[model samples]
Target: MSNGKPVYKLIDGKGRVLIPKELRSAAGMDYGDIVRLGVTNGRVSIRKIDIIEVGDQSPDAVKAYVRAAFKTMPDDTRLSLIAELTELLKQKKEV
Candidate 1:
């Protein structure tokens, strides 16, 4: 898949397409990896999602990472996330 050649694939009845092993390797995708799918200009794109373990990070570092991530998120998603976090904090205080 890394040879700059296009590989043809057929979508199954359930609309699932099998990605070849070479293509997956080229994209650095492995089993159990999270992926984000999006459509742009009538073409579908797949992106590997990166997850950071905050348990091992310092509070300041985590905050900085979160701020940077929030900057990349859509305004609606950021607002929704803020609302969800506020609700969680309210519940925690009640507990």
Candidate 2:
């Protein structure tokens, strides 16, 4: 395809487009994942709104890591982790 961009796909009767696999992978998207779509100047753009994976240390590394981790985690797991972290923070504050 031109400049490595995926070519067009026919939209279904229900107005859905099948996103290409390579494009999805490049954007870190997978099945069942939600994508954020935006329209600007009559053109649409997409971004992965939920994923903010941490790369090796940058200024906001911890924030990115926690954000990504939270996106895929179940509510129970998130609650447990938050509870643990809260306990640790409370201990630190008390010290």
Candidate 3:
């Protein structure tokens, strides 16, 4: 819905709904990934619990990757991951 596209999914009798791979992968989610759900205006929103890179081989790759990856991570995890990645990237550059 963020891109003005609508996604249709099926909710089963047991109150479970499966999110397709494309959408999940876009949000950096895979099997057993933790997600948080919230309701607003009678609509439910699901957010990924962590960041996962899905970028390609290109220039400014780390910058691009981190920005996109940060969008999906939970607030609590974002800063720590950024700090870790910053240190890692610095180390990579030093090598």
Q: Which predicted model would earn the best TM-score? A: 1
**Superposition-based RMSD of candidate 2 using all C-alpha atoms, in angstroms:** 10.0
Write candidate 3's Cα lDDT for 1-95 as tens digits: 45759888788999899887778878888665546577999999988754433544555445545566666689889989879989999999999
- Per-residue lDDT of 1-95 in model 1, one digit per residue for the tens? 67799999999999999989998898888765656577999999988766545474867546645765776799999999999999999999999
Q: List the residue pairs that clash in candidate 3.
A: none
CA deviation > 4 Å runs, candidate 2 = 1-6, 51-71, 74-95
Q: Cα lDDT of all candidates, in order? A: 0.79, 0.73, 0.72
Ranking by TM-score: 1, 2, 3
In model 3, which regions exceed 4 Å deviation? 1-4, 51-95
Off by over 4 Å in 1: 52-95
lDDT, candidate 1, equals 0.79
User: lDDT: which candidate is best?
Assistant: 1
**Of the pair 1 and 3, which is ahead by TM-score?**
1
RMSD of each: 12.7, 10.0, 14.0
